[model samples]
Target: MAKGAHGSRQAAWEFFGAELKRRREEAAFTQVELGARVFVSGGYIGQFEQAIRKPQLDVAQRIDETLRTDGFFERMWRKLIKDLPFEAYFAHVAELERLATKICQFEPMLVPGLLQTPEYTRALYEVSHPFATPEYVEEQIQARMDRARILKDATRPEYWVILHEAALRVPVGDPITMAAQLDRLREMVGEHKVLIQVIPFVAGAHTRMGKMMKLMEFEDAPPAVYTEGVHWGNLLDEPGVVKQVQGSYDLLRAAALPPEASLILIKTAAEDHRRCAKST
Candidate 1:
């Protein structure tokens, strides 16, 4: 599969789903029955079969075992999603995010992908990938926008974010783009789509500086933590590590301004950007 090709990604996922349905039938098991063995709901299995959702690696492994396919599902999953726009280390996290019931994120610098606007994302890519083709940057922006869609689903996770003041102060894209981006956050907050808190510069140094971490909780599986740097990402499911990360996240949350106050600050920041743009 070619990298960052949306059509190819969808087609490969469809093929994976078709094979899953065929094998389940060959094994004389209904979707509900298969889902039971894999520890997901019957509706979830149907979604997978219809390519409406992608199963995570562990679930794929369970499907392989349940259908006596040795490693077919697992292997296919790895091969099919490897070409996604995300880095190799982050592909798994992307899949898992779909299944999460809650997501708590801390971003010390730029806005998190799930909350970033298209213009904001494009600006980041332009500066970061200065020599890349426009197509590559657009593909990445599309992927980010796709990732953000989970927030709009009726079954959307309970999303919460803690942003350092720096994220709001940093000028990403043009002033107009920054204004729109911050305005989007304010809108999401007002619509009750997400809960947000911002750590002000006065808070001084605190936990989780110079790092970004996301804690995800699932209904059917243990929680996971994802951390990312410039070129790499890590996913941790180990209970101890997850616990520690959770504690640190709690600390960060405590240091942040209350949601109402944060909303006011965001509004102010958006106005600042808008005024700056107008003055220029």
Candidate 2:
């Protein structure tokens, strides 16, 4: 049997569980009754309602059907697990990315997650999770690829990125992979999907020079800033802090190369990587 949960910081799964419990009660059905309708054991249903276990998609759909909630539980399940591979604290940030009206990012070391290619992403996970199973790594890679679909939507958010020159030059996976990633960046620019600028080494130290920052503005919610360390991330929605971070991001953007020049620089770096790959 799974342990029940009641806590201060309720995760999305917990919220979904609470909602499920409420609906089940309102329908006057016992856990055993609901479990039978969903083809699961009563104990399992109890665990799910308590958020001790996350329901699988099919199970969640069945529960929704049983409760006649018209897919509410199913949709919540999908949103709750959209980025299962990310850290727990970063879940809200992932959700914000999908719904934000505008996204501005400063990447100091590697390609932004939204822009990284599968090959590059795989390489990163492999390095960071040296002991992870190959199957697990592949699952994470697929999740990241799925996240990229947000960029393809016609109603996608406006994206602006400022990448440090080092991110373009660093060899991830191999030179060929790096070149492909750079080419992808160039293609996104050409398609007008995103505007990118490069902060060259010559710019010296500036605001947010050592850390990565993402500022998101939403249509309905207040703006937020997300900053991450090696293993943890913080999402700040306080207006004063968000304003200060936004101001710093603006300064960094001003110091970086303009879009046209940045494109040239990116292409040149891509060519250099291509040559290196050929030589290797």
RMSD per candidate (Å) reads: 5.7, 11.3
The true-versus-predicted C-alpha distance at residue 269 of model 2, in Å, is 0.7
lDDT (Cα, tens digit) per residue for candidate 2, span 40-135 = 777667867776555666889999888999999988877665535566666557656877889999999899988989999999999899999999
lDDT comparing candidate 2 with the true structure = 0.84
Question: What is each predicted model's overall lDDT from 0 to 1?
Answer: 0.88, 0.84
Number of the top lDDT candidate = 1
Candidate 1 lDDT tens digits, 119-234: 99999999999999999999898888888888888999999999998999899999999989999999888877789999999999998788899999987667889999879887
Name the lDDT value of residue 196 in candidate 2.
97
Number of clashes recorded per candidate: 0, 0
Give the Å error, residue 48, model 2.
21
Candidate 1, residue 224: lDDT: 84
Cα error of candidate 1 at position 215, Å: 0.3
